[model samples]
Target: MNLEETYRSLGLSDAEYARVRELLGRTPNFLELSLFSVMWSEHCGYKNSRPLLGRFPSEGGRVLQGPGENAGVVEVGEGWALAFKVESHNHPSAVEPYQGAATGVGGIIRDILAMGARPVAVLDSLRFGDPADGRVRYLFREVVRGIGGYGNPVGVPTVGGEVEFAPAYTGNPLVNAMCVGLLRVEDLMRSRAVGVGNRVILLGARTGRDGIHGATFASDELSGESEARRPNVQVGDPFAGKVLIEACLELRRRDLLVALQDLGAAGITSSASEMAAKGGVGIEIETDRVPLREGGMEPWEVMISESQERMLAVVEPERVEEVLKVAARYGLGAAVVGRVADHGELRVLCGGEVAGSVPAEYLADAPAYEREVVEPEYLKEAQRLDVEEIPVPGDFNAVLLRMLSHPNLCSRRSVWEQYDYQVRTNTVVGPGADAAVMRIKGTKLGYAVVTDGRGKWCYLDPEGGGAATVAEAYRNLSCVGAEPVALTNCLNFGSPEKPAVYYQLARSIEGMSRACEALGTPVVSGNVSLYNETSGGAVYPTPVVGMVGVLEDVSCHATPGFGREGDVVAVVGASGRASLAGSEYLEIVHGRVAGRPPEPDLALEKECADRVRRLIAEGLVDTAHDISSGGLAVALAEMAIAGGVGVEVEVGSGRRPDVELFGEAGGQILIAVPGERWDEVREALAGVPWQIIGRTGGGGLKIGGFVDLKLEELRGAYGRDLFAEETG
Candidate 1:
């Protein structure tokens, strides 16, 4: 069956078919069909999600550029605006972790670069199966390596990210990458196919056969046999991508182009068609005019190929030569493959013969598809379970160690150490901090950044999941001593028409809205990627939230590491019991996976986050880390390991030792305050629940009324077993 047949099967109405036929002529061939499928697929097409995504609140005086283009931009003083975006590469990573993850990093960077911004930081939210599984291990290693390999080489800091493991993700691992960039508000680039009689230039990598039907590939479900579909995977060369970014940003500043877009997804065909359609103009392309990396390529290969490091530019007719000269100066490939036309038809010529022609709008505007929704059989069962019986390990100490060692809770230093996070001195607090801190030159103000998500929990409980992601990001920023000011998100989910999926999707949005409203941090901008499914089944609902906060004193930022020996240790905020709803502890350490993950109490979260930020700025808190994922035990252990010192703790009277030490609770922070400032610290948190849990001292970690472990032992849980494999 050809592409047209598939659309017909998708229940496209006669009007839609006639519109598509008008673009490709009488009857469409395989190539034309493939192009149609890609342009009309939900991912590139947004057939089902466009309506829902339109509901997000994206306008604000600070919003320099919102949603429709590459990444969102919001002004952040100092004559600067921040550009950032979060995106998912689930199917591809599950198929080929390394390259898939590498390209994901590559793509997001290009998005920021396309807007004339300099990428500053990158963070990833990863989900995998049990590490014991050989396949999962391989995927994990490769995916981490790929992210480090690409991001490190590009000189962008891979600062803060989170990892989680669950059985539900075994069949489809999730790799979501978010990139943040800095651009002068005045220099921001706009994407609209404007200007009449302009020259259309294809710049960067030459057209090739790679990812020939990639957009269609994304639209369909992944069969178990993904190895056979390697051809659909787009190969990445980060070095080339880095060069392209530099060239593009430089060229944009020189004012040599009218409009710009990165050639992603459906490649040349989609970019050109969408650009023209958005500008209400037509485009005429000569297939033979494209620059090719390999010979013997067909016209379709030139149009649909998803080659990396390529961009499209609409240049003023007279400035075409100047644009070509600038591209040449950068030693990049440049070609004028088409011309903007006054008519509204996509006219294509192959060696002077009209090979195909179509209405630009029809090819670009996919028919809105409504999906069948059936509640999953497991939803009710998942919510019906009683929480009173949630199990707590008898030997909580051993459990803490196990949880720390688990891939999800362990430290990510091994993965990020390979990255040069400090290359740009603007980075005040690098990878080890809760959020990546970068100084805004020429001003005392600085920015704190973080990205977060949890797919399984979000899939099971959309509202809670969505709220948790936003809260998690804010908590991270709080730990770094910043008050979150703005948020952006990349919503990744399965088919929206499925009632269960739509249910989750809608609740997640509601959750986000509530969290943002409560926190006083508005949603600046974001992107939505729906229809992320395979033949096996739909992926768990994954929504990544990227948030930025402000800190006037970058130098006072707190980190999750030990700062001084003999510093008094304190715990602030509420503490109760661990929620296993979507915890690695329940799924991995124990053979149980029931209940719900802890939900954030917006009121308590604000109090805790705000208080901690104040203390850090006042120089009363030496070090701090929010209690999340692995809870208090993991957070404390991470702090000790990072400081290369040990801690001694005395469990307070009333609270359960096990719960106080290992329970997963949000709105709580572990801090190391110098003895001199103990009184001041106590005064600062007056009227709020507080505890003098212990003190940081030389040597190993010691806990009273709880099972004990040495600081070195705790570090071993996250130091990585791979290091010994090579060192041994």
Candidate 2:
């Protein structure tokens, strides 16, 4: 290929070419150009979102290791630590849903395993187009199946996750997976190739030509011809992944590994170069020594191929034999493909011939662009609708019932049941709760996690939506009586080249930063996925927030179910009227996704969360559930269904019945307390805004004459399996 053709194929602009030339001090050969291309791609480099990602608070007392590592590690008491992260496999999922989604699970599991932790649980945050469309339905089914296929065999319980549907995701679906692992603080592994003479070992599956240029494929926008790029989607083997996890942990246990890193987006090129750069050392790789699944593969292809279920390890020269033994027991491929050197450059040799050499830092550190941000013109029209313009349903009961049956607000039991959520028996509280709670096997301590987002709200008001996303995740953790500590996010947005998408990205980050600072929860690790648009249009600016919190005593955590027959149900942080804008009520009842979502109050949110945690800790509340999406009524219905009991509530004369019942708002929670403890609960919440909205009861849910329904009726509406309904 000519020089210009080579540069274009490498996904480099003229300016980037100039920078590469200057950094190398000469023209790069084909192999060097290919390495630079994959490393500099937006997926690997974070060139567009890096500057904005810095806006997040990334340090805290509990954070043991933050953003710079393979995954974030936080101290979880009792000398144990938690390693976790959330990553996206969007573009690939759009092209090949099954393998794309399956590989996403495998990739994240490997990331957690790289930290020398045993992955205990997994969660997913998914978004797809309207299910009425055949293509969307097929994609949704396969994605879920894919997630289960990988996570189930790996023995990591798929505890909880969130899924939403919108028109914006029709062309390009999103699949973000999160994995959490447990290990002793001392057992933690770092991903730096520290020892100069350490042997670089390639572990697990053999390299192949599949998924070549996968990073560049992810960095570009999807088109009708995206199917032709299916070769860029890495196929995963869960059985191999499970075995690889075992081998790595055993290696760590035996002190055979000096450092470890997972081969993801850019494969060996990224893993090897990043390891060298992070440790301030150099690496020399013999491409011919790499175990390959396919013959006749070019040196560049072997370096950049994103084959799944593979990892790189820096092993002590003396322990190489032992490391190979463990990998052999697991039937995994292990070969010494490289070595750490003092030269500070990444050198590639093929057939004993030097093919490429470049400074490791140059490949690891890509340029960051400050894209122009302009507010979207559609925001005005989308946010113009007022609550008054939408008529209140004549029968509030019917409206609540309809909202309950809506897919976004309905039960996910059918979905989560497909995977094993209690395989290791560490799941204290699984799916269907405010957050998933898992005990740290040998200690009294446990951790709670939740993945949440609001695409409709974000589409209408990006700033409010972003703040609300973080605030809601914090509240979800608090409802389970856990103190919010840290978070990891997946920022899924449209192309950054568009000014509107750039504005959304910037404003959302700003809002999330403010919320994190207020809540004292730093963003420990995250992944940004841009260029999510198709020829049709860009998706709603969806920023999925995954938050983790700690529970000092696993026994003290609360669930979203009424524990007593006559417990007083109260609403906390319900100081203001609900906003109908950007609500399920508007979308389901009015058939419109318009209006500004209520602005999130960071101070109020923190206060409410703190007080709720205190109340749960003091044993003043038996159940706590955050009110969101479908608002107070739906929250009540969910709690009632979970407890198999009904509630009788007095909805005092309000502005509008529908608004009081189903309008969406943030910072509000429904708590159930013993009737005898009502006075004490009130005194404990002295300064907090609250009201005795209802009482847990027997057979029927009564709402002050506006609505009255049997417990079975409410259950029937709330428990309809959306997956079954849509697929059948």
Candidate 3:
């Protein structure tokens, strides 16, 4: 191939190649070029998103470690720290759903492990096309199986997550996985490769050709021929991953390492270079020393293999044998492939001859493009919807049934049941709840986490969609009575090179930043995945936010379920702001995906969540659920189905029944309290809008005593089988 063809094929632009040459002061060899290709790609380097991502609020006193780390760590009281991060395996999962998603789980687990934390739980945020399409069905099934396949064996509980469906995701489905871990503050480990003479050890699975160009593969958009790139998707061994987690923790417990980094994305190239760059030093790797799974692998292939279940750690030379012994105990491959150096560049040596040499900082810091941003013209039409022009259904009962059966609003028991969510025995609240709560052993501390986002909302109004996502997460944590502390996100979007896509990315961050700042929940660590386009079109901009909260006492927590009869159900926070715009009710019943999503009131959201959290903590509420997706009606239905108890209440207005009952809005939470204690609960939430909407009791769901459905019927519709068949 010609030089330009070579550069373009490597996923490098002409200007990027020229810049590389300038930095190197000469032409580079095949190995050096390959290193730059993967490291500088959007997957490894935040080349396209780094500048835009800075708009997030990322600082707070509780943030022990914020952005630019293996994973963000937060102080969760009692000297316990939580390290968590979310990453997207979109392109890979689209190509090879099983292994792509399985390996994705393995990748994030190691990120927490690298922080010297024991991965405690896993949460996934998924978006797919219409499940009626066989291709979408197959993708959903395999992706869930892959997640359970990896997380179950790896022993991390797949606690809680959210899933939504839309036509825009038909070809470009999104699979964002999050892993949260816990460690003592003193045990936190940084990724920097410090100490010049420390030996860099490669531990766990042997390097393989299965994931050769995985990083570069994830850097671009997919096409009809994308399936042919299956080889670029990593093959994972969760058995190895589970062992590596235990072994690495053992190493940390023994205090045998100076630093640790997981081998993800570009594998050794990224781990080694990022480690060296972070420490302001260098690394000299011997490709021949790395253990390979196959024979006849070239040095360049070995250097940037994107192998799964591997880690690089800097150990004192004197303790090298001890570290190897720990690996041997776990029956993992161990090799001393490199060493920290004072040279300030990552030097690759093959057969004792220099193959590639580049400054570590050069590979770790790719060119950040502040792309031109322009509001999408199509959005003007897409965001325009008249609620008054829409027809209101005569039978609200039938509408409620359809909404319950809608794929986006239906129950996820079939999906989450496949996961061993109780594996670690720390899960106090798992799948059915608004968020997952895990207890800190031997302490009163409880860590609550939830993942939330809506691609359709972002597609309608990126800024509003972004703010709404954060607000939902904050509300979820508050509903469960946890103080939302910090958040990590996975920003999934189409090519940022397009002004429209860049605008979405930029505005979404702005909205999320505002919400985070207002809610006192700062962004910690996150991953931005771009180029999620295919033949069908680009998926909606989905910035999945995973927020983590802390509860002072695990025993005092409220779930989204009715506990007793005659408990009064009340509408709390935000007044008369429900909009049919960008709602599940609008899409399912109206057959349209237009309308500007209701912009979130960040200040009101904070006030509402804070009040709800206080109510739960003070034992004032028996149940709490935030209104989202299908709005107040659907939220009430979910609570009824979960508790096997029904609600009888008056909720709606003179406006269209559909708009008042099923309209989507943020900063509003549905709460249940004893009929006698309603006065006290109302007094506590006096500042926020609080009204008696209904009472919890009976065998039927009755709204204003008009729209009514049997409890068993609601359950039947909500639990409908989603994957009974697959067309793909």
Cα RMSD of predicted structure 2: 1.3
lDDT tens string, model 3, 475-594? 999999899999999999999999999999999999889888988999999999999998776889999999999999988899998878999888888768888888888888889888
Q: How do the residues 579-613 of candidate 2 rate in per-residue lDDT, one tens digit apiece?
A: 88888988888889888988888898899889999
lDDT of 2 at 562: 72
Sort by TM-score, best first: what order?
3, 2, 1
Minimum summed lDDT over a 10-residue window in model 3 is located at: 719-728
Q: Report each candidate's C-alpha RMSD, comma-separated, in the order given.
A: 3.2, 1.3, 1.3
Better of 1 and 2 by TM-score: 2
lDDT of each: 0.77, 0.90, 0.90
TM-score of each: 0.92, 0.98, 0.99
lDDT value for model 1: 0.77
